[model samples]
Target chain A: MTGGAVADNPGRLYVNDKKAPESLRDLRKIEEALQGNLGRAREATVGIELGEGGAGSGVIVSEDGLVLTAAHVSGGVGDDLVIITADGERHDAISLGLVASTDAAMVRIKEGGPFPFVEIDADDTARLGDWVFSLGHSGGYDDARGVVVRLGRIVRVADVTIQSDCKLIGGDSGGPLFDMNGRLIGIHSRVGASLEQNMHVPIREFHRNWDKMLASEFIGEGPFAKKPEPAKAYLGVAAEAREEGGVEVTRVLEDTAAAEAGLETGDVILEIDGEEIEDMENFLEVLKGMEPGDKIELTVLRDGEDKTIEVELGER
Target chain B: MEKTRQSKSSWASARGLLTAAALGAMASVSPAQQLEGPYRLNGSAVLQAFEPLREVLQSSSAVLLDDWKSFAYGLVVSPDGYVLTKASELADRDEMAISIGASKFTDVEVLATDVEWDVALLKVDAENLTPVVWKDGEEVTIGSWVVSNGSTSRSRRRARVGIISANAREIKGSSNVVLGIVLKTEKDQIVVEDVKEDTGAAEAGLQSGDVIVEAEGKKMEKREDLLDLLGDKEPGDILKVRVDRDGEEMDFEVELMERHRVFDGPQSRNDAMSGRFSGRRENFPRVIQHDIMLSERSVGGPLLDLEGRCVGMNIARANRSETFAIPAAEVQAVLERLLEDSR
Candidate 1:
């Protein structure tokens, strides 16, 4: 992360060059701009360990030890965590809160310090094709390796997320994404369909919800947590809605209530609990109101014969 | 205690829960433009930044085309239309064609193919082709700007720029050779468990329960030790194996084949797409890893420096964060061998 510093000429957009560097000096200037911010940002970026789970990357955003990370990495508000800095120093930290919808989270070092931090560019002025650098503990913490830096372009910028061509992997989540000026622009969110398709949470969103995060106001469930759904009675049969007004069982999951009830593929479900099952949607709607262990009589059509079978539902 | 720990990370309020209906509705909503302008450029600024490199590449790079599809990109290595490209893409084609700009030549001949390095040399019946000049031993320090240029599927020139993330190093791949011998631990020594019939081990006179002492002069104390010795050896490679049979040490030459070739419908395509999309394959070897965003098809083209000098040839689009390229020196060495083979 050590490199020579370049002169900071404010108001000069680093990406104004519409062509490749014309000379070695131009190339040196480009290198210097990346190095200057990268050297400082690497120190501010830390590795977050969530006990038994895998590690993630985070950036110290405030001098008083406020750290920003992906909500998925933080897990939940008040979660005890350990943060490892670039120098491999471990610090105790607690998750403050998360904006689950946007996958943004904040944490604070329990032991306060004038920590090295990167300023978040509140304007979020990152445009398409602007040069950006990403630093993270890619492939987790390799003691032999220092903070990894990847230079790429802002592939896309939107209201909710900024997509970049920068390659990110599992351990890179919650890492800092900085513009060419070395300002924090986004937080690494998730990898898209391809390596070039990476998503980041715009720093502007983080600034907008700064107070709520500091107040420990938790938003939706953390990234890894499945959103809580209403308990549904599980017949455990893969079915398709037949055009002729019934749910056709395509496959029955083994060891499930449907399998135990002698449900087989090709069996058309006509009704449940004396309620006519019009289609797959209706069948699902009826089950939503029921719970596991609920006994219901199912009318099924098999080989041109209609038979009612008693079935005990399982929890899903 | 486990339940309490699990609950700590769970949502405390039901209001935040997303019902199945709600989840379905969210999916139905059009995903906010993940990309704008051309899907490839991501933005107009990217187009502008790449214009210069794209202009240089369009003149010096060619599209390797088959009868039906554009398979790969080729870098003009010589003035008289000698091109270099990835061998795998050109391996199974019925015919080879080279496309420079809008002009297409069908009378292209495969000069040589180096399977070990996954590069192919081709000679096109053309003249006045712009050859790319090498930077020549240019040390690509980490964080230096690098640009990858190649022919897109639309036959248009494209370029992606990034920094050198790592120096050149050997990145190992998983598709290794199979000696066809199962080794077992016996009395702190690696013993031959079973040598399948018609395999290199059986052909080399290896028998069940034979204690393996060394392979290719590397002493084997355990099963892992023998595996390490055979890790780098490929199929058809002659291995000088020494084994102890009934207190008698005997050396025998054994040939190695790929492990999966012993059985199976098809050897797993250890191709980049298998790894790039699934993120499950092993890494390549001896590559200069960079952050340039080039697709698998775009590989085999030249990675140019800011001064339009060929720094390397894009070899593998490793993953989301790293692309591998064969350095100029290595590419030059391969091109030399290819020329010799063609002669």
Candidate 2:
């Protein structure tokens, strides 16, 4: 890889030695680890059907069929559901305790005992870049299709959610996310526009509220808790286009980034982080890419003088 | 050998710092992480790990280009320029060129095509190209790690990693929403020329010579207006359809049915949220579904397993998360039949 045709292709970098599996031997070891746990993973995974045609997935954690699924998938407390196992057998079940804030919920199969189950990662040991796999009934379960499996690595682990590149879709919500060792680490909750924006409810959230959930209590604020829907960055300023050049700020909301940054109603925003703001529309286009808590430098014209102000955006 | 080993170890440690910096940027929490951007699994940093598998995989892969832009990727099946690609994607075979191993060949001939399998065989004016080594499909089980390789925007071959997401089985096409009516245009008026038997249109007593006046309260003046309304509707959806039969306005409730049961055509909607997918995605005899993100242009390339062995040729990009590949055994059978037919 040092000196070959790779050099001919400009703007390309091919480094053979790095963090990912560098050789065939390394890749095979990863493959073996995934294969060893696959059978157990499949047996414990189940498809969930909300009576009104909504579908999801869950994993059996206990021998008595205590299942962990997404709070949204669980719906209202005591809502009856049909649980379909990997073998295509359907069983009766009902929603149990739900933690709406973190999108964690529990369910119990009514009839059967000694059901197949996977172990949970009680230690919350999932680290960034740890190899993980997700299992669910993608596009809902088809007898011939069986349960679907997706492989990815932990990209980001927040307090309530874990993000991965294991591309998820509709009907995959509430599916089980497991480490290479088959330990349940998270449950699928929501998917964003891209392939990597898959968010899951970390198992630690379930563990923290396990006792409350087992008691069939709605833990997070109410039955329909406001789950963390990634918020956009807010500047908290109303701007009107001015014929001269930049837009003039008409109003500044109280306790917002703009007010905190000493922006007045008459101040004209000239630029954002050195980029010229043509008008209100251009300023909004720049703000669309910004995230909450992002600190930006705003150049404004006040009293015929330009001033630079630093502001930390707030969540909308 | 010792010097090379030392440099390799140093590069590994340097990359480790780069990986840490990226994670730190996300962990800071002040700046929201770009969730849509590349992550650990699909990022370019991860591609460095596939360098060892690149030479062999890239050499055997071929790309089909139209007007200097690649439209499909092909697998070199024989040393003497015998290649295979998705048949339906080649809309105009005469205008396409085959690019393999730094050589672009325009003197390409279509040998044979299997319509049901969507496989096509091509003969190019080149020789001694590396062909892909086949692996048994039985070895490809669910949850197994598989990698797909094809030409990137720079025309450089790159690989993406994923897992076998589902069982290797037949994907029935046309499981999509439909109105079950053969429409025709008569002087700017949308007319139902024929309604299929046992369909929602026929059940609602919609007959030929009926001019469709409105659907779901939206006025239908042309064939496109009715199509636009039907596009937004789903199967099992009951819509109020108003038609004029001999100047008499009457309303009937019509329920949409599956496309396969009503007609033989492509699926109705391409999930806009998932991005562009192959127009001819479904109805494969057998497919090994995986979650590797393959663009429509990247389809028809080689799908390799962890051991850097070819397990299949990517047949279609279904959606953002799903890509379908024809098994190696099945591909070989198609090649044999195509060769026989060409002879």
Candidate 3:
């Protein structure tokens, strides 16, 4: 963030400083507001144990044990997990729906109700420079360490993410980010290398997908999505850059397109469908756009002669 | 991996852009937008507004330096030129001095030190210094607004604002203390796999085939039983260990050491991201955990509440989110003991 020129306060506080306190009195007011709601917030924050191995954090949003967490932490729909509450009681839970694009996911506890929960920011009024605090079982939950809290300000706000100065790490993902009023404004996502570059799934995204997530349906697509990625087109040959400007096939696996097309291990692939393939990287890029089972012509250099061969791409 | 690396580089470039934009914002004086957020908190206008208040509270603050570079900070605890600071930060420093405004005091004496609290009492030649005003027994609850100081350069400091992030409690060496022995289950017995060289186990003459029988008067039934015993122990703690070496009961007094010192393993990702931390971070008797981003060197100063009352002394920069401070009541007790020892 750029440090703007210090201008006069013109007898009125800027909209940005609405939450960031400027004076001792205002600071005291924020302290009072935060202290009043801190207990409830702590009670809702929970530790999540991934079935595969690692751990993360989440926040209870409903009394029936609806938890809001990062999509990456929730993994896939119906994935079983153990949720440890503030009092150190563990409950069985299953992953619900998730919007992978926003890194937002929901989990429902299998046991019956009356769980501690915090309210999401209903007004969606969180903005830049707003004072916010986050709670998580950082570095995993320990009965001795308990829940850790961090206070910061929203440094940058994006469409689906809000960047805060609050420092978060591996186990802090899926934790709740709250305003001074103890309203959940975001869910902790991934963290950047810089301490101030922590990303959070904005509360609005959860609000938008509230219905879909409740129905236990996984939605959206991205790297974090539970949906399977499309298969990449395979050429079935381990190739390297030749000294003479073409990709030299080091090895050709059997039962593949290259072996079926009579492309030997020593064949130098010069072009793919008339486009010059300079090296191994270039060959991979051309194949990336094409789907599995696509037929293409390969310009190959066998011995001292250039030959054309038609090959069908295979699934990787 | 590629995406996260790209984002990191982008953040670095964005920081470069921020510097350029900041210069541009300053160069053009056409009623630009008023600064807000962290920069505003760091900027002069807001800092200047709190200058008078901070000046009075920070009068007792002292920055210790070596070769004109700040290494640690301290607070004037008495009118007789006594300054208290984090003890471990001054370890192995031959040339130590504190810069008071424009004056540099090179003849600083290490009057006394408290190993448990990691605090030291130093005496300078000067007298009639403004001792910090401590609010004894004041309730510093979580979410309370707190302030600290960061040293930018020699004798130059900035005000840092944050809140009490966690309840004040005793932080034992839950993660740092270690026996320095690799163990494995051999036929349902917790057998020593390997004893690392120069560790407490090796120092106690523990061999590879020795089976741990007892630790600290407790019988070890499994590997976790020994681990559980070590979890409560701290560095420099003496553990009375008894081992069965080929049906021979051999007893040894072992002194435990820090985990990182014994085994130089990879740091936790969070700790690696948290720039620098105090060498002696854990095992405080009682500490007020706050979210103020003070550097490791900037610790040892006073932590003040919004009312300009000194609540505690900053002791350790634990990680990116947590900075531990010795609470006022505890600081008072340690200060008394140190002063008593100094005499």
Candidate 4:
């Protein structure tokens, strides 16, 4: 895809500059820093393309080029792949593993690093209706240049992160979620009806499973000082304990539903059907409810480990 | 075998013809015309199959990542209602919907497909009647005129003509007799004179698969349009074959062999290992699996042989496109025993 920066519009982001009160100028500084950091963030964010499977959205969560995204965007992929970075640079990355229940994965870039990075704020309290921000990449190496920030309202205080009037798009999956203080709030998850409905995984969830995500290329930088609630099922979808540590993708069956969905062999699974998956038992039990040909999303850790990706649901 | 000489030397002529077709209609007096009048074709057929076929297809439905501007071949035979098509068509499924070519969308359920034979089955959600009839292993004679039906873009079907060049020839891969077809016109023709191994007009003392130099008696410009001319044919039908084999050009009175498929379900390299064979865990430390190419669509479908007899159900695709088919013959035996007990 041709890579470049897309201009900002109120409909696209949560914190509209015009809406930022003068008193919150310091907060706006974070946004400016984000824009500056994001320009360089190209090194961190990678554009993913799985042949036959549409291109997916991914972010550099680690300095080493470890990107993060929903697993459904990259898991169980069978098509050829091409990875592109900001500044229009293109590289190749492979998927590691996929936890069927949680639509998440891990991808790895083959070469070059030292990319612009986003630091996750382990202690920021994400309040309801806080103006959150998002940065995403898409087609053409130049297209992955801009960011989208939408006000994420804490709509549901339950097990799910249901925010109202928040928007994400086909190219926004797996991007970062930022708080008003410009701290990382969550990872962009998925889109629903209209631009107002969107889903995201709390950035804190990464801290919950830091060990697993750190198993590969990640050197933990987060000072996560809090613990999330214990796991439980939500809406018939199994919600397990936050991963003690994230899992790296070891194998992905080629041409299966997973492979066809564009999942490679090294992607790491992060979430499933909106539920967070932690271990093998939790993962397997979640899968029992779904039959073959079920489509879901997955978040994974790719090469250079910190990047996240979002893959569309395909066959298992 | 005969068209090679004509096409290799008649490239310009074919282009001229295609350009003309693209500009408007392909032709009328195209000797390959077999149908009576203008048959009205409606919207695409992607539904209408067994309940299971529908269930699987509905779940497995996906859209091609990119929309293809042209029409592709799709057929239905029902491996108990699951339709079969070429694997290349279903290789990359985006979501559960297929992009409509020429502004139309066809929601296709790709049940099973194989890379080797490039065959796959998809279940569409609509229903019944008017399925294309098959000519069950009909023996085709040499030198007969035939017709072909195909579409270059989605939604439109066209017909062409050619001839039968060869029949029942060995091509190496086990299974069926692969035949060859050829075509030749007046001034231009393309094709190779002859060769060995690969089936087509060559085995029939005709060296085809070559470029046609002259065709339809038109001025021989270069080779290429020959295949298009020849493809306009049907099995058991024959016409003149001007093939170019091994850089040589020749014209053969070739007979066209009809295409027949061995209703195979999903199959992997394990054709020899059809049934579930498990050994005692104590006897073997672990079960060794030979992963071969299989297709996801093969699930819940039947595998057939050259004789059209059902062999097994395609279970999985491994190592890319390799498939594994579970023998229906074995499943039938189990069913017999179960029925016997009920009696």
lDDT of each: 0.70, 0.75, 0.74, 0.37
lDDT of 3: 0.74
- Which consecutive 10 residues in model 4 chain A have the weakest lDDT in total? A1-10
Best by TM-score: 3
| DockQ by candidate, in order | 0.09, 0.12, 0.09, 0.00
Q: What is the C-alpha lDDT profile of model 3 across B3-88, one tens digit per residue?
A: 12112221111111122233333224333223254343344444544554577545678888877788888888877678999987
User: Scored by Cα lDDT, where does model 1 land?
Assistant: 0.70
Rank by lDDT, highest first: 2, 3, 1, 4
Better of 1 and 3 by lDDT: 3
Worst 10 residues of 1 chain B by lDDT: B6-15
Candidate 4 chain A vs. true chain A: TM-score? Answer: 0.52
Off by over 4 Å in 2: A1-18, A222-316, B1-39, B92-94, B150-155, B174-270
Highest lDDT, which number? 2
DockQ of 2: 0.12
Candidate 2's residue-wise lDDT over A1-316, tens digit each?
Answer: 2343235433212222224655566666666777888899988999887643456789999887889988777774555788998888899887766886567888877666579999988777666666788988765666787788888877766776678888876667788998766789999876665667777888988988875576355666532343333576877775655666687887787778888988898999999999998754466668868999999999999999999999999875
Candidate with the larger lDDT of 1 and 4: 1
Of 2 and 3, which scores higher on DockQ? 2
Q: Where does candidate 1 clash, by residue pair?
A: A129-B46, A167-B320, A167-B321, B170-B286, B171-B284, B235-B256
Error of 3 at A123 (Å): 3.1
Which wins on TM-score, candidate 1 or candidate 2? 2
The better-scoring model by TM-score among 3 and 4 is: 3
Q: Which segments of model 3 are wrong by more than 4 Å?
A: A1-20, A228-316, B1-49, B174-266
